[model samples]
Target: MRIYLAAPLFNDIERSFNERLTSLLEPMAHVFLPQRDGKLMRDLVDGGMPLEAARQLVFEADINAIRRCNYIVAVLDGRTIDEGVAFEIGYGRALNKVCLGLKTDDRTLLPSGDNPMIIAGCKKIFANTIELVAWLRGGFLSARDAG
Candidate 1:
């Protein structure tokens, strides 16, 4: 499966986490990330570029990557939902792609009722890295089965 990985990319810790997650997913399937350089937009801010331009670049790149992938695996562990991840989820759902959310944080932080990461129509939500791997490898049998 061509999987688009969406997550927070503003901080070093978050970027490293995403990288590790990408590595974990790569062996099972093709993983797509926004930046080939592995530098998040915030990292570019130190180089004197305007924050707005950096945001635009990241957003465009992420959207383009989402368009090229067959499914979306979103990281939903931050204090607030990453805008880039949210946009990717929206685009994936709009395109009728299979959407899977990975929440590394405690479930208690989430609301009691429904999963916020599931969006309106998404049904799959994995709790952690292990479950995500299992779901990706076993639950998703084929590309046609994803949707």
Candidate 2:
């Protein structure tokens, strides 16, 4: 299955996290990352393109990737849901695509109230990488069967 991976991408830690995720998923299926062009958007922004324009480009690219994929694996571990990731999840959910959310952050670390949107949007959720991968592979298979 083709899977669109959505996560925070602006930070160094996020870049490492996404790389690990890509490696993990590579053995199972095709993995699509928004910044697949080796920081082309970042380079554009650095070269004086407005930050807003760069952000719009990334968002549009992510949405297009999500639309092209059959499933979404969203990383929901940051202090808050990354806006782009949230958007991808919502789009996938609306399309009736299999949605799996992985949270590296502990529940106790999340701020006060539950994030109903994330909970409702994801068909499955996992706290660890292994569990998430297992769930995603299974879920993708199930989705294929249902379709």
The local distance difference test score of each candidate is 0.74, 0.79
Query: What TM-score against the true fold does each predicted structure earn?
Result: 0.77, 0.82
As a whole number from 0 to 100, the lDDT of residue 1 in candidate 1 is 67
Which numbered prediction scores highest in lDDT against the true structure?
Answer: 2
Residues 1-147 of candidate 1 have per-residue lDDT tens digits of: 688887876667987888899899898778886655334565679887899998887667777777777778988775556666777787899888888888766534356633455555455777789988987787556644767
Worst 10 residues of 2 by lDDT: 106-115
Backbone clash pairs in model 2 (N, Cα, C under 3 Å; residues 3+ apart or in different chains), count: 0
lDDT string for model 2 (50-85, tens) is 998887776677777778888788998866788777
CA displacement after TM-score superposition, residue 25 of candidate 1 (Å): 0.5
Q: Identify the runs in model 2 with alpha carbons over 4 angstroms from their true place.
A: 37-41, 48-53, 107-113, 139-147
